[model samples]
Target: MEFWNDIAIEKSWKVLIGLRKEIDFILIGGWACYLLTHTIKSKDIDIIVDFEGLEKLRKKHPLKKTPFLKKYEALIEGISIEIYVPFYSVFAIPPEEIQKFSIQVEGFRIPEPEILLILKQQAELARKDSVKGQKDRVDIINLLMNSELI
Candidate 1:
């Protein structure tokens, strides 16, 4: 997965292009944070989509239902992509909010600092594992340091 850290952004753009216009979603989690900080390493991609977006994605790819994670997941080009549908997760950030914080980078719409901070905070609290919680904390800090939010 070390190679993932080097090409994460490029790979993200490829995945977005593959999804095309049919999906309306925002990049979230570690990958999103990495885009901003450009210092973190993430092996997987995390996204949040509305129900309509989920349905649209279903047409193009095989998504395995992961009710446990409040997401539908797929492995694309060796990267695990987790797609969350706002309702089931404790982190229910609306698309409107996401749009407001979104930035277009290399043709991919990625979540900005404020949104990443919000999600990271939520993840820090929701994760029971100390390691995950700590990683979330570090992500929050990175976003804070690198973003224009300060």
Candidate 2:
């Protein structure tokens, strides 16, 4: 299990780097929390990208458009990328303003720790019974207790 986790963690970061190489994005969701709090490594990637960035990603990967969900989904190296767009994807914060609320970290962009906490709390509220919801809980507490953003 540990070995597989290490592999999963490695692949997650690799996908992040590869996505960075492919297009500009603001990292959101659990990975951003992990980057700040170092509590949990995310299983997938969640990012906010503009139309041009989305186009670049489309050129590299097949995108599944779920307009109802207001986002796109793609798979890379067996890891999932949930791509949210401005004015389309709804969140605790608007997608367009996500950039304004973010900060640059080691060449990637992530939301402010306080913003991340809000995002996580919203996510937890939406699905408080599932496995990922459980993760959201852990992330929320970690963000409050361990993250410097608060």
Candidate 3:
């Protein structure tokens, strides 16, 4: 599958926007950083949802319960939609509390850049030495330099 290139990233972003029509979610990960800083487009889409919302998503997609990774997942148009739930998901800040830390922009709810930084930091630690981790470092830098949170 094409990944990280502009075409793939744009397609991923479009998938994210399309999913908003059916589910309520708190945007997170690289896409959230893109909303705040516009640094780099995310190669994949990540979002936080309540249990009810997760069920709705499952009705439409083949959602996988990946307890080991602490999130649910599905694929749409070759882009992964990684779904995080409050109790089951691991995030820098609790997923349920993410709403308190978020603001609406472009019809999507996303955590503030400060929280995004923390989340990116956690991701970097989790995937250190991988290409995704390298992108996380760049995203962290972009947020620190461009976001008002810094």
Tens digit of lDDT per residue, candidate 3, span 44-147? 88999999999999998999899899999999989988999987787768887777889987788999777878899999999989999988888898899988
Give lDDT per model, in order. Answer: 0.72, 0.86, 0.86
Write down the worst ten-residue block by lDDT for model 3. 1-10
Query: Estimated TM-score per prediction?
Result: 0.73, 0.93, 0.94
Model 3 segments more than 4 A misplaced: 1-3
Off by over 4 Å in 2: 1-4
Error of 1 at 131 (Å): 4.5
lDDT string, candidate 2, 55-78, tens digits: 999998999999887899999989
Give the Å error, residue 127, model 3: 0.7
Error of 3 at 12 (Å): 0.5
TM-score of candidate 1 relative to the true fold:
0.73
As for candidate 3, its clashing pairs are: none
Q: Point out the higher-scoring one by TM-score: 1 or 3.
A: 3
The candidate that wins on TM-score is 3
- In model 1, the Cα lDDT at residue 11 comes to 76
Compose the digit string of candidate 1's lDDT tens values, residues 3-50: 344576567656656764667678778767767777665666778788
User: What clash count goes with each model?
Assistant: 0, 0, 0
- Positional deviation of residue 42's Cα in model 3 after best superposition, in angstroms: 0.9
